[model samples]
Target: MKLELPQRDVGLADDFSRSEPLRYLNLFRLTLAGLFLVAGPSLHLGSDSPTIFFGVSFAYVAAVLSFGFPDAARLLGHNRLVTVQVLVDVTSLTLIMWASGGYRSGIPILILIALAGAGLVGQGRMVLFYAAYATVAVLLENMFRLLSGRETVDFFTVGITCIGFFAIAQVARLLALRAIANENLARQRGVDLASQLRLNRQIIQDMQDGVLVVGEGGVVRQFNPQAVALLGAELREGATLGEHAPALERELRRRAEHGDSAHSLRADGSGKMLLARFLPAGEANETLVYLEDFDRIHRQIQQVKLAALGRLTASIAHEIRNPLASVYQAAELLREEKRGDMQARLIRIIGNNAQRIDRLVADVLALGRRDEALPEALPLAEFVDEFIEEFDVAESGARGVVVNRVPPGLEMAMDRAHLRQILWNLVGNARRHCSGAPAAVKIDAALRDDGRVALDVSDDGPGIAEALRAQVFEPFFTTHSKGTGLGLYISRELAEANGAVLELCVTPPAEAGTTAALPGAHFRIIGRVKP
Candidate 1:
């Protein structure tokens, strides 16, 4: 990821460029002004042209004020501004030396300061350029003084001063480059730190367990979205935890004082069990808490157990097949031979029970090897109507016992074989349990508001007891003695595999609508509807 540094009105290098030269020049100007003002007989310093020196000092003050204006100061931008200030310093110092004492004046050394500042502000060859200009201006001023017969030229002093300017420029340039390098290095570090902080926050927010940091006084400092979901309440920063979760706050304090590492508590009103861990967050009073739902973990464990059982059952069923076929063949042979009346009846019973056991085995094997669904869009209303017709003809004695109320043109996407098996099991159960001519067995199908196809198979018989409702879909759980018990379990598994929901709904109250008053067992299947 690219590092993003914090922004500022002025950049580091640019601010250093303009501010350094301006600062040094202002100091030089003010110092010269002060010297000229105070240097006289009273200060034990005398000047040949004190009046001209004072006038030049006043002009320097005016130049300082002019550059102080916002528009004028920034007119040439940062880099150009620094260069201009250096040039002005050289010229002003040259004139000041002429006014003081021609070539012999010590003020010519002050020009070196301006050239050194240029080295700091400007880079590379520009440093040499500024030094060259300063040297030339000083020589010209001294030449003018000598030609006018004010003083004689001193060749040795001029040559040494000019060499000093170049030496100072090179030294200042090296220092400036080092300082810039340090600033750039520090800026990059800041950017990297910011990027790391962002990445850490993302990882914390996406964690599966809910996390919270709470102060000792119960105020919430931070919380993840999962914490809100698990607690069934919003946790705002700076808000008292007692307002949202009193039980949780009490538990947190208890765990910390007793030196416990973790605690489990149920959320108020929600009845969701949360396992929480308390860790000190590098502060004496602040605590970082992680919460995870106990029910979710239990459910995951339960699924793993069920999967193991399924594999075991598949292995056992394969072993039973060989012995079961042998028993069926022996029973069939006994029924074909002549026998006494009681013996004949016993043989028939054996054959009938053997066939029932065989069918049970077949169903169990089918459950073990259920095919993956290759779903297709189907007109549900038409499909159910056809199924009811076929079922009526197949079950001769159960004619007119099944009723359907599916609206025409309704559609759903489902595996045809899986759908057929699920519907057959539910409708057959309804048919077997019904006791009247009006047919309490009914298939109710409709398109729900949320774009799902809802199909409910309900009966008008006695409803399932609350105690047994929980186990209705469990494998090998059946109220009937002859039932294999894999029917509802396999049906639910198929429904889930196809991304559908199959649930046992509450039987409607007697005072409610007609369907509710029937008080039958209702199994509702909801799945995505095809457009």
Candidate 2:
């Protein structure tokens, strides 16, 4: 793992130091002035001491007044303000110390403020100005000491003060330059981020997909251009759930209230079907939905395909039915005649295949009609038991397929005929595909606390791959030999007619021992319980 460098341990402290130069400088100046004030009453100069200290005190008070920027300069940017304040500080220090007998008063060496300000002001001309000012002050102070002679002298101390101030001033100057450079970089980054956000918004506006941005209050804060066009909407902010697009609004509320990530929303005014891909984290209080208009596409495709299949069915019916009758009659004729064992077996095989073909054709005809259902309040426990027992799937062991544990007393409201058809499709598929597997089929149900039911009927023979799962629901889609492949397509159709959703359950990874083969598929039926 890469170790993260702490901000404060590096540039952050320097940034803070640069930003508040005046606050700290004022505090330091006040502290030094306090010391000077206290020392004032204790010192003397050739009877002129009173005048000089009074002048120094007055000058210090004037400097404090300068600390607050004038009203006109407050609106200026911080760097410029700091530069102006530093100039005021330098001028104040020069006048106060020079008029108070220069180095004689030992105040001529206070140059750290000037040094700190130099960093904020930056280099080139500013650095030279600060350096030249410091050099001049020192020379003037030393000349005063020479004129005053030994009685009030401390030349060594004066020299040390000048050296310390000059050294510290340069350090402050360099750090200030670094701070300004970093600030410029941060400003540039902000500009780039703004540009990217604008580009994203424009792209979303151009999309055919309806885009909505909702806030924490469950109000639609932003409904993009595509959303407005699709809904024929002229809505304002603060629209609540179901205000403009009821289907989408209801779904958003479902997602908000239940934290559901998947929803199918259809609105009638646009005469279009809308499927939504939702991204909801559990904590989200409002949801954004992206509408994909696949209903129009499915309808067009279904009409064209259904018409073509209708003609094909009518043409094939006579050709298939006549041959099928001949095959069945030949089998009967052979059974009536005294036949050898080989002849009898051949006749049986032909008759069985012909009958199977007839069944297949009948099933195709049934699929052509729209499924009709009569939904009624159902006891969840009774249906699961009856459906399984009536289908004879319990004798799973005879076919080498294992029936995994079943949850007892399972119940959900469902149409009896629709439920029976669904079970038949599942059992038939299990018997065919997982015939030799170790009895790996299971049917189970659970009634959740919120009155919703989840039904699972799975087989542990083979699993479907991720890539093929999407197409599994399409009509006539299958992967079996010697089969019509309409089993699941019909199963889902019946399940939906009963107001239940039938979806393919993905097989778990190999690490999950109870799951089936990687490409094997399981089916799920989900719906609400009777109120």
Candidate 3:
């Protein structure tokens, strides 16, 4: 909440906190050197010959030189150097006090230096140490004056002068303590924030997407560790755009301007293929480009393959239905004309074999690619509910179950017709495999704050075990009691077709304490929601 410090300095931690301390150390030396240079030549020491001016200059130079060898710096010991600085300071002020009449010169100004220095360069003890030395020096000076008899003052006058010096020193010491406390707290918070940022950066880098950050003039200011490794480009803070990844740098600039460039581009970088993407990454004023690798690209290609398969299935089913009808009718006619068990057996064989072939053809066509393009917005909740209702009505719970849901006015970017098939397959599996619980099924949708619209359909029926969440999305996976297990395989393929991912949602455990959330077998579709 402190407005003076940068965000990165506010509690951000790194592997080693020494880096922060080192910065302050360097500044401490430089600032002292500058102060001495400015004040040394003009100093008169209030009629006291203190080249406080000269000795301080020597100490500042020593402090600067010490940073080059930290071990030597420590051996020199802060206590010793600070003691030397304090002796010079207090001696100079004590002489000034004697010459200008005690407590009358600008000698009190020296206390301000002690207090501010404590806050900036050292700790409370360091300031208090200086204050104590000055206090004793002032008392000793007064005692010497009384002994000399050249100083003739009433007891009350000497008392007031003593009170004044100690009072100012006391106030200055307290201020030093407060400033030291404030400074340490601020530095600690800065370290914490730095740590949080580093963690978030690691998470961003771990993602499969190639994330790049663009800065002023299209400079790659910040990027993920993954991007560097995947691209095989070793990049640092000030590296130029072209040297890291030529195509990426140019694409980001183009996107930032919103020029007449393609929204999605498949680029061939050297020998590797990359899906170029531009998004407002992490936050605004920063653009991120995510390049999908070959694995996701292959999955997308398989989705195309599935779409083709779906179209082919639909066509072949249409053709086979005519011949299937013809064969059944001819068998009926043969039964009407004959009277032998052999003829009856022959007719049944012909019908059953033809029907089985028809079913195989049906499954194959379903496996084909989905080629429909979405050009409309559908109220997501309402659409899902309507689909579930129709599924229950048209297909009984014999092959698999289907839950009913039609949330009205819920919206998402999808082809309503195509989405119907995805829901059909997903809900069907939940009903079929899930057993002994009145065909448990559920379908729901909700708006997420993260700019993704989501739909979840779960079953209390036989749930998929935890081990399979990773591999379930691959093509040809199924656990059905019947034909191909392409139901879920195809459903996921269809959902992703419109930039939506249908994932098996993970559930929290039952009896996982009172704070536990849901743990039902669930599938979700997340994507951009309609505004």
Candidate 4:
């Protein structure tokens, strides 16, 4: 992969760049210059020309000090600055060596150090050029000494030292190249790791199931939004999981200590049933907890089953409708003719059973058409008034039984026909079971805290038993002998198709001040509200 290096100042390199090695080379030059200034005369190291030697050493120290300034590199560029420093070192040291007594004084060895430092800091064949420059300076100084008879030449040692300079330069160059390669690899790895971290966070945030990373002490190290929503509490990183969800914490403890396989808990705020699963996080005794809504999962499974069942039942209902209509027609014709009392009673039974079969067929057919819902914004108060008028025509004796308490102008978004069907099933059931008293069955609509409109239909009759509450909406489940058992089931299906929820309210309070309490079965429809 192509890697992009961080931007540097106008002329300065970034970290692990040539600037670092150049600084070290400058420090070496300064230290060498300082030593020469303190001990040169006493040691007779520059006796040939003490004036020039000490002056050059002092100048070199000043140059090194100037190079150490922060802006020096930015002003002269890294490569150009390093070149100037190395050139100064070679010229100054050659002068000192000539002042000190040629190659015999062992002064040429210092040139080798300068060449090595140049190789480490400088790029390409530039270090070789520095080595060459130093080599020529030493040879020229030796030549001058030989001609003037100032000192022995020692050509062999001088040549060997020059060779050593070149050799050290090559070795230092190789080492610098290796170090640069490693630095680049490290930078690439850092970029890759950061990208992976961001990707993992996005994945976790987008996941439908809640995920939490818990440490050894049950402290949450990381979590996503879904975790907070599923747990029904605010959770922060580094906080103990027990503070927000004690039941979940207790379940985790039970699983850890007793090896319990159960993983279900109720949310604190929403009381939604949650299914949790835990897995090791692969480090420091950390664990990964995944939370999912159990009720949602069940509904998904039920939808899949209902989809297949709807297709089969639709075809069967179509076949039964033809024969059912013929039977009903024949029963009507027999009823119209003169007949004995026993025959008339039998005919009535036939007509009643045929009509029941027709209703069952129609309910089954409704399930098949659930996917065809066309939802729209419906004014709650107006819809309820129209529904009550229509219901009154069908059940004259049950007229005025349903008290509508929907506020004016409050609108709900749902499929008009689907919502009407759902309300019809709910109100019909309420009318059948409620006490025949004024306002015995109440229909009320209110805006819920979650921005959805809740339409409740409650009756003043004995509520459903706790044992049967769970199966109230299940298909083919019923309590009455003549009940079709699919009314609530079909209603719930239609509600879901319209993106609404139809459920039995476990504990419904009285309608506010307008009527007495409805201590009976209460069914509620929650749907989106129009702005």
Candidate with maximal TM-score: 4
Lowest-scoring 10 consecutive residues by lDDT in candidate 2?
1-10
For 1-531, candidate 4 gives per-residue lDDT tens digits of 654434432112333477677777777888889999998888788788888888898998999899878788779877788889889888988888888877766777788888888887887778789889988988898888889888776788778888888999889877876677667778789989999999999999999999998887789899999989988889999899889888888878878997765599998856889998888789888888999999889999899888977865775566456657766676766767676875677577677767778778788888878989888999999999999989898888766688888889788999888888888899999999999798888888889999999998999888899999999987767887667788999999999998889999876667667566558999999998862
Candidate 4, poorest ten consecutive residues by summed lDDT: 6-15
Q: Is candidate 3 or candidate 4 better by TM-score?
A: 4
Backbone clashes in model 1, listed as residue pairs = none
Give the root-mean-square deviation of each candidate in angstroms. Answer: 22.8, 9.9, 13.5, 20.7
Q: How good is model 1 by TM-score?
A: 0.51
Question: What is candidate 1's local distance difference test score?
Answer: 0.75
TM-score of every prediction relative to native: 0.51, 0.53, 0.41, 0.56
- lDDT pick, better of 2 and 4: 4
Report the C-alpha lDDT of model 1 over 11-103, residue by residue, as the tens digit. 335665447555766676667656656662344222556666667667666665566455665576766666666676777677777776765
lDDT of each: 0.75, 0.63, 0.60, 0.83
Q: Which regions of candidate 1 fall more than 4 Å away from where they truly are?
A: 1-46, 101-109, 138-161, 188-192, 195-199, 202-207, 303-531
